[model samples]
Target: MLNIVEGVRQYAKTDRLAVICGEESISYADVEKYSNILGNYLIDKFNSDIPTVIYGNKDVMILVAMIGSLKSGKAYVPIDTSSPAQRMKDIIETVQPEVIFNLSDKEIMLDSSVSKNVEILDKATLMNLMIEKSNTYDFEISREKWVDNDENSYILFTSGTTGKPKGVQISTYNLDSFSEWISPVLGIDGSEMVVLDQPSYSFDLSVSTLYPGIIFGATLFSIPNSLILDFKKLYAELKKSNIKVWVSTPSFANMCLNDETFSQELLPELETMLFIGEVLPVPVAKELLDRFPRIKIINGYGPTEATVGISQVSINREHINANKSLPVGIPMPNSVIKIVNDEMEEVPKGEKGEIVIVGPSVSKGYYKNPEITNKSFYVEGESIFKEKSPVSALDEKLRLRAYKTGDLGSIDDDGNIRFFGRKDFQIKLNGYRIEIEDIENNLRKINEISSAVVLPINKNGEVSHLKAIVVLKKGINESKLKKTVEIKRELSKLIPKYMIPRSFDFIDEMPLNTNGKIDRKKLYADIVEEA
Candidate 1:
């Protein structure tokens, strides 16, 4: 985990460039000064044994403090400073950080449960404290690994859209394999500077923001918080920087493709667009291809449990036509993917089964819940044991417990895994059961669309109907756009008649939650109010 920091230590010996953001340009040497000061402070205060919560966006201080805390023998929990007060409070209370490094003074107003016992260090106070303390601390640079390989490096709280949030305990070993697998796929290199658009705390997308950029020593550029909502402003800011790689979710990329001002003229510097976090609609992929035909658009797929992405495939027009559902492609090197039946036996090719991934990137389990831990994690052959037969217990114990992915998929004869949809997201509507993702995927085949999301919404009549909210590509007309509803008409030929969305709502923007998922609850409320 300190590999990134140590790399900075090696190349950043002089005052060469390191990090750049709004109103801040710091040298490599300057970063180490702050990192060392913060490292010393953490070593003196926490002694590298307890967990500390680091709350902030992509600030230089947060990066420095993270390295310093880990090098000093403490794990850090990154809180999304942008999250709601209640959500942030819940995370702080759960983690119960012995010490916290935050960027704001208002965080002092956190729940009384946390505000009382937690040691708080705001950025201003922490920077002043670092300035006051002499940087003369011995640089023995303890080769000692402050965090064990399996120990929790960070406690990431899920988006919690399902219910109460669960903390995902990620280990140093998790990150190590993650970086190793993703680095080669992304084609990272020294000259390939990328922008950090997502906040550090958002789980899966963080790999795009942090790991690849640092591993290849590429420069990282950050956008101002105010411009995040404005496509025109964001495009202007992006064009101002010499960014070559743009890594973000398909939603953000679609927004760019749909905006009139966002063309090759503005984003000429961008060459690679790495998309993850959600499915990439085919139309959005085509729009990007239409503009930057030479640019490589990577569609990466994986759940957070698999450490960002285990499978990826480059998008092209021919590949999109070859299959209704885009193949997630082959697993990364040294990683194995197995499709097993309900009985835990390997299923035949082209049969849908639970996707069980085994690799170093898999997390240990959810924190503090052994019941869930045992259910999700267990020896593979334990269920097959015959006590009377006297099978070797040791052999069974060494068998790998395949992580039961909630996702359902199938592998073709060539071993290309195709994601069908989430097992839970499938629901019955009218006389038919449907996978909501399938309708969304079909709607994406339209040429004028940028993206689409489908969900069942309840009407005032107390009946649920399929409703699709669509975001269109640039220059699509409301009159002509409604004509593009023919895509759904075409979809009727493919899917069951009951699966079609009864009504289509065209919107300038889709509501997104803090974690970058479609805010279906909010979308439902908005449609009802409009009705």
Candidate 2:
């Protein structure tokens, strides 16, 4: 297996630029030097393998800290600057790191209220340490201090239904497996390529671009949250970025498409557009194809539990014109996806069931919570590979670890995986089981509707009704009341009367979270507050 740190080190010798955020750029040489200095500092300071918490956004130091932590045989937990103080407190309590690297320019005051006794390295202090250590200490460290492949590489905290976050521990071996599979699919050659990164460091989506890009010596061009919110500035930056590989959520892409200038002309170097974190709507796929005929629009499917993505398929004109839901694609090499029922029996090829993933990319399970980990992550009978072509001969002996994704999907007759939405998204209304995706998909088929999301409105403890939030197409001159009636009428023909949402809400744009997925939780909260 290839080591990620070694790969970056190989590129560092040539002085290739590794990361670019706004006007700031860092060469691979600097990245290696800074990270090594930090790693040595960490090893000397702590003398233990406790995970370090890196608090920042897209700052270059965040990556340095991540690499430093790994080099010191410790995992790093990345918390975005946008996160609340309370959220940071929760993670601090959970991990209880000896050191917290605050790489942001903002002063993050963590006293007894948040942390008891922990060293906080602010940006100014960290920079001084990096400079002092670089002049005084050697960058080379013994290989024995490097984290073992099976040891945790990073602990990513994800939102939990219980109001507390659950950390998913991904091992170095898991990341290496993910990089092995993703590197080829990303269309990167020996030549340098500029990769567009749109997600926060905290989000696993960044992993899809960061690790693979670094391994291939591709420069990562990141769009900070501020720039992303400003369309004029964002488009100007995109035009200048020369980004060849675009990685973001469908919602972010759709937001970019809102600008007429966001065509192939602006990003002529773009060769690939990767979508993850949510279902890619047909309209969004079609619009991109129409704008960039030569670009490969790839859709990937997986959760943070699986290192970035486990399955991916390049979208084509045929898939866009089919007027049907697009398939998520076949399982990547060294991974197996099974659609099974509640009894853990495999459902018929075309029948919908819970999507379970088993393979190397699976995480070590949630950190420090064995009860929850045992319930969600485990190994089944044996590893089964439906498609053998992509699997490497050497990977046959790899032990399979299974993760219950809680996502409803099925394998089609052609062996393509079709996503039906989340198992939790299925609502029981008046004794009829309804898939929220079904309602949303059918609603999107309406000519006037560009995007739709169906959310259940709960009364007391039970779902009382369904609410459909939609974004109308541009240049539609119809009145809101008239258009709502027409959409309801059109949607009724495709779905049962009971499946249609009782109320319709038209929004100018869908709210997307930091991960770039639809913010259903925020939407529901806003709706409740408005009521």
Candidate 3:
């Protein structure tokens, strides 16, 4: 179970730098040394399965804390300190962690009844402890003494836009499967100076930023949260390093492409631009490909349950047309993808339905909620006089658990999956059924537009209207654009009449969530209050 960390310790004997944060860089030997000290401290402080929370920005201390907690046979819950205070409080209360690890000394008031005994340790104290015990402890956890694969390694909470956030428990097996498949898929070797810009406590992307770097002896670059939105500063800082891979959300990719100077200078060195989390818009895809022809732009897809991404597709000029979206391509080797309807029946080729993923990379279940855990996650037909599944049986086709991704999709005859909007997000209006994304896609497909978002308006038990917010290309004017109402006429040919937005509001920019997702709720509020 802890073989991942053990591998790092073994690989540390060579002359290599393991982690590279802002001003400080640590060698592989130092990583092993620091992690040993921290792991020992954690083992001494808490008994097995005691909950813990790691706070603050991505740094060596955060990495050590994660590894240390896992080494002590406990699941570490990651709380993004940047999240709303109310949300953070709710998570801390629910988890009831024994310790709160913070690098920035961020304080949170806890309820006395359940969480009064929580211990707080800032980054300075951790670093001082590491220095004080420098390379002193000889830690040993042999392969013979392996912890069970079922033991949870980390609990990552998803943003609960639909309900209160639930912690998704990912085990050592999930990490191993992901690292095995994804590392080779990206052609990750040890030499690349990959930037760890994504928050460390986030899903598999955080794992992607860390594990592969350690496995290959590559230098991991850490970016502070404060610097993510400062595009100029970020690009300038990135230019200083010979970074080969740039991993981030599509919005960040769009931002970099929009900056003319960054496109001309900094992007040349970036060999792989990996976009995950949201739909990889065609406009941004085209711009990235046009500017950096040599760079491989991979559009990968998966929910948190799939351990980062289970499928990947690389975008090229010939494959994409003006009218179509790039398919998310094929499943990664060892992953089985099925597009099924409500009846759990498979959909035919080219027909869209819910995407259900079954693979070794899938997580166990939600933490401490058996009702959800049982309903959503289960080993089918296994309870009928069955034996335990062997590690070698990962590829064996038996009745195993599958994650019902609420995401809607269809696999073409060629096995490429095309993503539609979410099953919940789709709407029907008047006499016509519609996908809001279809309308938004048509609006942005026009050469005159740069960005577009579609929202459905409901009033008293009826989906009565469709609203669109758009940003025009640099030279287009709203007055002249008003003459393009016929544009909707063209859009109606592609989408249903009800799907064509009745009203169009031009804007300078589309508002985005902190995670770089389109904040449709915010857009709706702005349109209602102002328009």
Candidate 4:
């Protein structure tokens, strides 16, 4: 963590570029200067230790706010602008922030719904921090409160299977563990390398790029949501980006691979591509190898509970020939990836079991939600199962923490770990981790809906999209298309746009199995048969 702060300082001294978003760019000096100014502003109004919600998409200003909040000893909670107002309200309720930074130029009206005495640093106000007293802020005072060690650096809210959002609290130690380990692994050597920043700050995937890029003094070429929505602009950005390191999900890479222009010729300087947040299909790996033979392709795996990632595998011709599916690879030196049974006993190398990650990188746990945190996370000696069968006794961080990822996996005798998806109703579609039950829970809340079952429509070994099996109330009179539109519009009020099903099947009644529960298998079969 100290290295991270020093890295920023060194880069600022060098006057190198830190972030680039389309036409806008923020240099290291400005990022440091503005963040210090903003940090000083934050220290005046609120407790330095509380989390502050930062609302925006992919703008350079977002980075300044993040660094500033960290400098002021407050963890920044990122909420994307595309997020539903209800979702935003849920986060505000969870974090109970005293201040919210509206980094974008637009206004976010939370006037009527939320009742709180929250201070908002709107765009103009934030700009004023840079304008009014940019040269006279107490940089040393903000630096004195820099977030470190066990203190939460950032709180990322992700989809909860219980229908609420879970804020995973990654501490400065956790971020430091991740960034330090991945830098050398990715072969970043403090050079002026350009890395791609595709994911939003709200998502942990972006942390892999943003933090490491910052700490390593690498230039980040940010692709905002607006440019991503327009292929012409997205490709245009790519053509111009002298990207040496590519970090994005397989879904985003697949989008780029769909166009013939996304090849070595388009990004001649590109050398490393890292993928996570979803399954990396073999076809994508094969195509990338064929197109850019000189580039290195790596697939990483871990949950938000354990920093950005804990394990990684660099793919090659042998891996392509030897395996049907890719492995997430071995654990980092600072962590241990174990396959454990329901009893929490270590499963034999070749046997399938729950993937458990233990290390310093594991998050402090979900913020303010002790019930769920106790269920999913645990300290090493705290668990009877873990105490009975301890993993590596000499391991330094063994006593720190461990996260029980509900993901199924198996490790070979050689220490390579392979993933077999989740043990619950959660799925990743289009690079977004989603809980199907969360959508189902929200759907049942709609007055017109009786019951809903959300299913991932699988295509070519990956989820193509989501389909909802819904049953309306007894006398709701509307066409299927009209009802779908209406239902979607209502959903827009309850959840993020990504969680909404791409297609809907309005059914008179949901199929039932021998048990009283709705038969998801039957509905899935019926849908697949129809297609």
Candidate 5:
């Protein structure tokens, strides 16, 4: 597989556009030259592999900073511009880099408590550094200066339940492996293609498009966060984007699908739709198929620790027509997925268990966090499984580096993996264990319900009952008391009386986090406030 640097080197000879953000367009040669100049400057300044914190959104320079940091042999931590100062401060303290690349054109005011030892460089300073380096320094670095495959390529900070974010350290080897597996899945050839870029650099979901698009020399059509909120402008851009591959969370697509014009007519060249960061609801898949009959809708499943996705499968017409809950799909070529019970023993096929991934794509571990890393990542050998166990051969072949996904799933007869839900989402209420997704899935099956999220309502520190928040079908009367009663009645027939939500809250749409997944934390807070 061609590494990122090699891909850039090959593409740099051509004048094809590599990135398009708003009215700004950047070519492959410009990307190579600018990144190299910035990289050489970074090398001269830092002279170490300490990660540099890149603060910005969907700017072209954010990509430049990322490539520059990699060329300088340092991993980069991307902080979104919308993130609260406190969150940014926390990351600053955690990574504690010598330099911070502030790509935003506006000045970022930081607290006085922030370290003064760290130098902050904005757009002008960054340009000066590049120009200064270009005049005297050769853009190319010696081979020894290049980061090893085992060394970190980037550190993506993800939300932690403990009120801080944990950094997921993805190595060069991990990224290369992910690119190799996802390239074919994305149908990316060297031929020019426009890949949609929706998520910000901070979110690992962006990695899904950024690396592969760069490697294939495809132009990335980036949609800024501000434009995403304005549907009128967003669709207008989509019509002109000529986007071939649509990469986003299912929620984003569902939002776009609300308009009648979001069909193939708007983007005739659109061939592939890749959904990740959450379960692809059956209704969303069915609608996409209805609108874009020839489009390939692939459902991918993985956490940040697993380098974007480890399992994926294309949603076919059969899956939409027949399956109640769509399967996440088979494991990627470089990865091995096993469903195991509490004791880490492989569960019987078709039985629900925690999803454990063992493979090349698995990240090294959380950066500078051995305790949390040890809890989630490990190695399993012969002693952990029976001699003739089904996974024993895979363990031998793959060397058994594993990550406990904390997600519950099971493999079906056809080798397709079905996601049950998060293990933590399972709650015990009134002496019964229930999966939240089970209720959510059944709730979504109702014709009037467009999107549904189920959460356990806690009473006295225990799950006492279930609460549901649903987005009704566009024309449905959400405010009517009878509408909710009817929804509850329909849900009762699909689920047990006890499993039916105690109360239903109807909304126009579900809240989405930066990564485009349903923002359950925000929803839970809303539920708490209502209670």
Candidate 6:
């Protein structure tokens, strides 16, 4: 893996573009210089070593702040401006950041939920420090302060089975392991190339582009929320952005496919398209192949806890021609894919079981939630992962981190890995891993709701959107339309917009199984399957 901070500094020796968002762009020289300056400022301003929070949407400051935090040996948490105020508050409470960079145009108005001393540097203030305080270049940050080993590279707060979000801490060691594998696998030659980074910075999918883009000196062409909402501007921007390697969800690609101009002529330099964070439909893969005969379509699979993706397969014409399901391919050089049964024992070949990913890229675990972390992630020592020593036993830290993905899959005799559905109520919608109970818990919080159940609405073997069923308290007279509008309006405040249900059903009573658990299968049959 490329030593990201040092790698960028080495690349900064030359005059090259590092990031380009809409009309705005930042150079590698500036990225190195400014991030160093910010690092110094952070070290000086706050004596504490707590993580920093960056609040923005598709801005260059966010990138600088990220590297700056990395340089100062502090992990950074990126919060998208699209996040609801409550969610933002929840994250701030979790990290308790000493300083937060407000690169967005909007004001970050936090109530009593956050500490009053959390310093916020707006776009203007941050630029003033970076530009006006260039004389402080003499105060270079020493490599001793640079992040390494088990220290968190960055913390990503994802949806938890519990109502609140759980932050996944990816250590520097994990990032290094992932970078080493992803670089060679993708054949990134460390030259200047523009890569499309369309996902929101808050999303784990962004890491695929963010770190690699910086390491290889690729120009990250970011697509902001504004452009994503308007097709005309998006197409116009796509025509302008000479992105070579494409990185995004299948849904985003499918949206672009709606435009006839999205073809070889639109992005002639585009050669590779890496799809992660969601299931890539065969039809979508086939469409890209039909459009670009020479394009390399790589389908990757892993949870954010596994450092982006642990396995990838380059899709070819044969797979599409045969009308076969895409395989996620084999694990990386340092990782192994295993299928475990109910007893936590390895399953037989070709048999479906819960997929467990064991590798160096596996995250330490969920932050501030030890109970759930213990339930999901663990460490293992064996010949495959044991650190060899002529003297005696290997160091415990050298063992492999194994994550029970809670996802079901099977490995073929040829070492090919196929993904089945999830083992639990968690489902992937539009690339976000949503725990069904997370939404249900939030729904049950509604004053009028006595009981609530949420289930995924599947279409064409993909989770289209969430559909929720709720039973209001008796005598709460309200029309379905009025109640739904009111409920969604309330839900929007409690969770991210993507987690909110697109459709709702009012039920007379909550169905239960023999064990008195919510009969989700019955609700699915009545609400999603039957409908």
Best by TM-score: 6
TM-score of each: 0.74, 0.80, 0.76, 0.94, 0.79, 0.96
CA deviation > 4 Å runs, candidate 1: 14-16, 136-140, 159-162, 379-401, 425-531
Candidate 5 residue-wise lDDT, 1-531, digit = tens: 447776776799998898899998888887788888877887887898999999888877777788888888998899877765645776788898878889886566666666677789897887787676677664676546766567898998765534456799998878888888898889888898999998888777888888898998999999998898899999999999998998887768888999999999999999999988766778879999999988999998887888888888999988988857888889875467889999999989999999999877888789888988999999766443344436344335443678998888899998899886568875544333355776777677788778998888765334557878888777564465777789877775554455677877777888899999999999989877876
The digit string of per-residue lDDT tens for model 2 on 1-531 reads: 656688668888886788888888888888888888988988988889889999888876777888888889999999887765545767888898888998776776665644456789887888888888887554676778988667899999865534356799999888888888888888865478899877887888888888888877889898888897788899989999999999887768888889898899999999999887767778889999989988999998888889878899999988988878888888885667899999989998899999999888888799888987998888755427545445454344344688998888999887789987667875555433355776777677788788888889875334668988889888347787787788887875555466678888888899999999999998898898889
lDDT values for all models:
0.66, 0.81, 0.68, 0.84, 0.80, 0.84
lDDT of 4 by residue, 416-510 (tens): 88888777788888778899999999999999899899998888766788999888887457688888899999999989998999999888898
TM-score for candidate 1, please give it: 0.74
lDDT tens digits, residues 1-531, model 6?
456787678788888888888889999888888999988887777756699999988987688898899888899998898888778888999998889999888998877767899899998998889777788742558888988777888899988777888999988778777787777666566877888878988898888877777787878898899889999999899888888888899999998999889999999888788988889999999999988887889999989999898899899878777665788888987677889998889999999999998877888898888998999998876765544433212223533788999999999887888887789988898999999988988888788889988878778777888888889888348788888999999988889999999988887898899999988888877763465
lDDT for position 91 in model 5: 76
- By TM-score, the better pick of 4 and 6 is 6
How many Å off is the CA of 17 in candidate 5?
0.9
Q: Ten residues in a row with the worst lDDT in model 5?
A: 386-395
Candidate 4 lowest-lDDT run of ten = 382-391
